[model samples]
Target: MDNLATTWVGATAKQISRAVRRGDTTATQVVADHLEQIAISDPALTAFRVVRGGEAIVEAEKVDDQEDLANLPLAGVPVAVKENTAVAGLPTWHGSAAARTAVAEEDHEVVRRLRGAGAVVVGVTRMPEMGLWATTDGADGPTRNPWSLDRTPGGSSGGSAAAVAAGLVPIAQGNDGLGSIRIPAACCGLVGLKPGRDVIPCDLGVDNWLGLAENGILATTVADAALGFSVLAGRSPAKLTPPDRLRVGVALRSPVQGVRADEPNRDAVATAAKLLGQAGHDTVTAEPPYTTGVRIAGLLTWFAAAYREAQASGLDLKTLQPRTRRHVRLGKMAWNRGWVRQEQRDAWRAKSLAFFEEKNIDVLLTPALATTPPPADGHSGGSWRHNLIENIRYAPYAGPWNIAGLPAIVVPIGLRPDGLPVGVQFVGKPDSELLLLSIAGVLEVANPWTRHAFV
Candidate 1:
């Protein structure tokens, strides 16, 4: 039996809102379509850690009951929140076995912002344990890409990408500490934007000491992402038009030494550069400004964050995953080293700031990943130490932006011969999201891919 509700699965967030607000469709129907698609698709995709169909229906009814649609730009739009974030009644286990499984008592500030914008929280998506892995396999299971069930969806925002790609939802909230959102978006053929540092509110309330992570959106269209950003950011994105003859730096090599991008990945970058040239940008080959100390400082800060999370879990170290336990110990060591190395870290930040401020480049383009999504079960079977090394080999291009606290976005450029998606990344100076997004929007129109999953 074909559910007529499934028809709305392919609709964008804007389309759904327009229909619902104009009385062409009801909020209840839109939510029903998404919940039905989730029921049909998530079993194969493993995209959602939790589905809140009952609560989402109730919420939709509330949207229907509201008399004013003027303030609700996203009224009744079904959206997914990453499990690591709080949503009042959902468990924020953060994909860890040792963490509390109880539902949250209050919404994270990001969730509050989304709800206030009239977006419906349909479910919480899955992630790796504490977002330690690029693949979205957790205690729950691995999330498979809709295009290839044998392949991973990419994480820690893998589930969100999978959900959006599968047409199960129009928009999903994802946080990127290290390519969690953009990597998955690249692998799953969607638009993923990691906003400038602190653009989106943190779960813990203005307390992102490292400032490496930011909540963002994974959507099928640039307009949808822009809409989500506006709602989450509590303001409009810059309306500035991209300057004619923009200076675009094309980066083909990974910043990490000894790791090279695959041919398809390299080709993606070349293709992007050509497209930008056609769009009137002065494209030039460029290399990332690398400081010897940046990588070390980033690793230490990551470990420190891990250590704090492990300690906060209150569970015995033995009960946690081996990776988490190791990170906790290493993080403690890094925290101790922070006293001496803080200056090096600051210097690295200055170097990054100078790279953008001093350089005349408007955007730096690079391959989103070293390669297309690796085998779903690959790079994960070995010891935690081995797995971490494998992760770096696969995703060498992701961490630099997070460490630099800059804005970066990944959009699908083309698919590989095997039909897997390949993406190119665009990095911008601090708070240059509007310009970056404008550039991306132009490219998106130039080479439009299917908005729905290829499958």
Candidate 2:
């Protein structure tokens, strides 16, 4: 895989599996090819924190020997998991040294499903500490954007996005508690989908707020993301979510996030909204109840989670990257839970559902990232400062959906002048991840964005 790697990076799991099933390509060959590519390309890319080379080969061989149709859908696909996920033999560190010693005892439910479906787990990608930041600026360091070596790939899920974008893997699993998945997708020119919480079972009993993030796939095509959903979606991982009549709601953000419909992001989402309307779905440009208050209210949950982590472990808060340190400070300050604020946020959630129910709005559409792609050199804030603001201003929409525990899919719709990507999000009702993925496939067919390579 070279510049030619673009074709394979964008290959859907379905394509890889079909090749393996037909004996056109052995799973061993496919996994080896990606491993070789990773060897040559991943050093500067800095996309992985854990490389499971030998371990992955053993698993890929299982695919080669597998004759049963039980794992038919993803037999030869090479995938990367965010370092935060436990993959049996591999360690699941939340990108922190404190976790370095805690090797995983077993596969996380998400990892288990991917393995059960026969996707090869090549390695674990990088992320910010505890997924606290939107940019992948970890205490460990930043992961570069594949589209431009000097730019960021976007964070928490940054390395996963970079790996998939750089053609290291066909798909990489990403979790978005904040805008982790979409941020990188926008930065790297890929498709990212964050489904409703627990639409897939999380074996560990994580706190509800921090659990806002859900594991999803970052791929070059919507179908690739759809394929992951088929192989590794829901509690047991189901086949492709069927497409159906989906009513779409449009939430143009309030003026506070610093941009609007006049902006490219706004236009991209509006265009998507119009396309949905033209597709015979109902589309309305409106606001959910706590529309104006989401930014402030949502921060409560994000900060609370960060605060708890820091206090519980005394997280060496000072040692964290500056912006993250500041977040820990802010989180510590919010010891008081504002039920009124939560009530408003919850009311917005209820209102959103009532509207969805009334208008039969099965899905909602909005900007994946509030602003355009950040400069390739990354945000202008001090590493910590930039990390903080980038998370807030650029990623205003994704978290609200996360807080609501609703499913959302981000599909790349267009590219920026710098050759970066921009995406629109589709928010669905709770547990509607399958429905969201199916709709993403429809929109993906309506507009495909891929084959981008940095080298």
Candidate 3:
């Protein structure tokens, strides 16, 4: 029953909610169709590490009967959860052999919210061992791009990004700590957003290092991303909607170290800016003091926490994927600080606040990554580093927002010359996600991206 394929396939969150209200579709059909798609594609793409056929059907059956579920915001929508997030009765493998047999006894907050909203969780997507390197399936040796089975899907949330981009589901969950969500979104050609720290309670992630990570989503459309953000945020009922006026910031310098902007990425950002301008908002292109040194410092801080966690968990650092282990090990080292690291962090915060104060800009815009898509397959030792350093340049655009505990959004402006998609991120101040979402809704109407990259 291709409830998702032919039915409101491109339908926004509002449309899906309405369809469920009208009983034109039931949560069971939506979950079933997506489950069917996963059954077919998982073997070829290896996008998902685990598929929950029985659990999804059971939840959907409940939605099918309950009138309350039909009226719920996400009544019949089907979604994928990243494996790292716990789902009661499912294995919460942080993508490692250690947790291979460790099924979660309770649902993670993210999963709880999704179920509470009546969304059917059809499956849990793949991740690198504990989300170490952007190693989506490099750990399991299965993760690859749906577009080109040979390319990498961008780590951590790569499975989620790939699942949605492939249209297996309209949207899927992703966790971003150091560009995990955005990186996969960029590579898979989907919309991804990282909310401000504390915007969503991360019960398992106890890191004090602000920038190393946060949770977000990958969706076929910006609205799907918005709905996912809305539900997961657990915003107090007092905040019903995002504000109307949002302050937006534009970055003049690249956040990656020693790297200049790539043509496709720049073109994409320019396209998004033009859309922002047409939408009748003030825009500026000044260097926002966002820097790579700050990135290194933040990574170190994150590694300190991750290392402590690894030691406590008694997980073998060596058993982890090489890239993830290498980076996490590097995180245990000394800080690469001076005037630059501290200054970037401080100045960016001030710049963010002033951007809103002076220009009434509440959100910032930039590329998730500075390059076009890469091969879906994992890269080798040194070549991987060079590729990551060059191709994944400017990931900081999304990172700074996470550090500031601000929310960020990305939707495709359009695709590049090579037929791969290029995207720009919209970042909102802390708790201003509702406003950022409304802004995204405006752009969505202006330029809608149909998940047309693959057949």
Candidate 4:
């Protein structure tokens, strides 16, 4: 047996699970190591809203007590849930104290699935108020990027990304309404996968950002991500295989007008395309139909989601953060105007799918982010307009995919010239979750990236 005191802080989820199943180490010991690391590292990053210290140890003990462990895919792994998600006994802090909901009596479906798969929930991570912005910060403080404390990890999954990048947890649960998961994955150099709509249960805020939001996994390796995704989707874990030769559509154009990918971001896409070629895939220049209606309706739907969430949570608008208050107000206006229509969203989804058929491509590749992450702190209490602008300017790629209700995954290609990490996005057709993971796995092996930030 290995030393019980040996830290498993930096080990991948698969490694930890395999070790525990083999009886090389106890689940308690692994959870203890991760909890200790969280104690040491999370103070600097503010990644967790609350650390489930004693509770997690007890859960890990339960895993160790199981008579048979062959079926537990995530056996003994420590995972973090995004603050907005329920984790029975914890109040769902929807980004801030004012937005918190009552203590949950039972686990959310995804949380239950994780626990059933032999994972322990260490804590829930933080996010922006009502998850309205791309930079994660609240009255508690900013969730600093592990790569660079001055920059954000990216939101609303910022805390989850920071926790995984700092090795505080092997993987985490994050929901991407806009670019929440992928943007942070790009910023922190991790694999973030947002499944197509309805692939996994959403049940978040009223209507899940008008069907634009979906739950996802963030991890340092593609293997861990695939494991987490399979658990969430309630499927048996399957090994990822290299895909056959596929024609991949490559685009450098930003989805949002007047916002273009910077040199490093564009180069990241190029790097990803080159890796695809080396993997025996064809890459062609193809742009999705980012029509004027899709852009405007998507923006209005984003605004209206905030308004609907506030109303459903019974949160007093006056008590919300200044930026969130404005967002909710705008949401109300957008809702009243009937601008966020289901027909428009369906139309875009149809158009997005047809682009692949017309272009004869298996998947589309684009820059995960347009520019570097914004400053982490000031935006929390600052102007709503500034928050919106900064978010759209840096992260214009991931939102359109969400609007299209298609699966998208972000794979870290390499580091940027500024020392922060950069990643590229791969959008696939419906029911192509495994295909997207396969493509990411290929890039991961062809050109490896730093697994975790040197926090």
Model 2 residue 175 lDDT score: 81
Poorest lDDT segment (10 consecutive residues) of candidate 1 = 202-211
**What tens-digit string does per-residue lDDT give for candidate 2 at 12-88?**
67788788888888888888878878887888888999888988999899888866744467787899999877888
Residues 1-455, candidate 3, lDDT per residue (tens digit)? 22234544444455666677688777676677667667766776777777888888998898878856443677777888888888888877777676454777988888888888878888888876667556455534657776667767777688888778777777788887766787788777777877776777676554534344677778876666777777788642223333344446676456656666578888777777777787776677645555555566555555565665565567677675565566556555533322214454555666666666675556677776666555655443334365345334534455666555567777777777866667777776677666666776666777886573432
In candidate 4, stretches whose alpha carbon ends up further than 4 angstroms from where it belongs are 1-6
Q: RMSD to the native, candidate 2?
A: 3.1
**What are the lDDT scores of the predictions, listed in order?**
0.81, 0.72, 0.67, 0.92
What lDDT is obtained when candidate 3 is compared to the true structure? 0.67
Candidate 2 worst ten-residue window by lDDT: 372-381
Clash pairs for candidate 4: none
RMSD per prediction, one decimal? Answer: 2.2, 3.1, 3.8, 2.1
Candidate 4 structure lDDT: 0.92
Better of 1 and 2 by lDDT: 1
Rate residue 401 of model 4 by lDDT.
86
| lDDT computed for candidate 2 | 0.72
lDDT of 4 by residue, 1-455 (tens): 12122469889999999999999998999999988888778888999999999999999999999999999999999999999999999999989889988999999999999999999999999988888888999887899999899999999999999999999999999999988899899989999999999999999978888899999999999999999999999999979999999999999988888999999999999999998998899999999989889889878999899999998878898898888899889989999988778999999999998999999999999999999988888987898898889988999999888889999999999999999999999999999999999999999999998897746
Measured against the true structure, the TM-scores of the candidates, in listed sequence, are 0.95, 0.89, 0.86, 0.98
